[model samples]
Target: MSTSAPEDFAQALAQRLGGQSVRQLAAVSGWGRTTVSDIRAGRHIPSEAQLRDLLMSVGADESEIASWQERRSAIITPPAA
Candidate 1:
């Protein structure tokens, strides 16, 4: 998989939000607004489960969720020398 910057991943997740408010997404995902806001703002990279919940709350299908997970992984995992 290709590497992705943290900001790029955050931007892609925000786009998936499709104009939904942080409060709304947090409610649907059973998380706090600040958590959602942080994730959207690239200030946080959530755990895998949290990411799954956030993606699902935004209506992301399994494939989409997996894609996001991959992107997140790319950002966190270091490249080989």
Candidate 2:
């Protein structure tokens, strides 16, 4: 398997959540079809607000959501101890 990573959480989530063929994001706050689609396609990046909402939509708790938000830019590098 290739070690190369995918673009971002949005892409990964979309894949895990299934169906890139659709353009609807019903329960995710402030996120309609276009925003989700753009993020998944890597055509655009999501804002902090959008990121948090995405996590909540996917059944993630506040802690997980915070972790995802706090480390979005840090995903490219490991954090120091």
Candidate 3:
């Protein structure tokens, strides 16, 4: 697990996609390269729409998408902290 949920998501995505480049993925996702780059670099935490777009672009299954969403929620909301 990463210190941040965004990092965890980015790491998992990188591993899942193997050698695919972020630029290529961004092209496929119809999103800006910088957005993907920011996400992968842990410089940006995606909004819900962005998350859904990213997961769908990567062909992530329902469960994986849900898991990411849950992780995002947990991180953003925290536990009364």
Candidate 4:
């Protein structure tokens, strides 16, 4: 499996947001503006619920959402020693 950094996934999501402001996306996603901003800035990795909300709000397809979720899992999962 090809692995992508969480920052790259975050950047893709930000680009998918198009012209929408972070504040606007937060409103649409029912999350705090700071949370959305942090995600966009790659300072925070979104929880599954947050990811779902973001994908839905931005009308992301199932494939895109799945790809992001997989990337997220890879980032958070501990590596074998």
What are the clash counts of all predictions, listed in order?
Answer: 0, 0, 0, 0
State each model's CA lDDT, in order.
0.87, 0.62, 0.74, 0.84
RMSD of each: 3.5, 4.0, 2.7, 3.7
Writing each residue's lDDT as its tens digit, candidate 2 over 1-81 gives 543333655556566445424344544455777777676676665677777776666677887777776656566456688
Tens digits of per-residue lDDT for model 1 on 1-81? 764488777887888787889989999999999999998887999889889999899788999889888888888989999
TM agreement with the true structure for every prediction: 0.88, 0.61, 0.75, 0.81
Error of 4 at 25 (Å): 0.3
Lowest summed lDDT window (length 10), candidate 2: 19-28
lDDT of 1: 0.87
lDDT of 4 by residue, 1-81 (tens): 754677677787778777789988899999999999998877898998898888889898889888878878888998889
Better of 3 and 4 by lDDT: 4
Q: Distance from true position, residue 34, model 2, in Å? A: 1.1
How many backbone overlaps does candidate 3 show? 0
Specify the highest-TM-score model's number.
Answer: 1
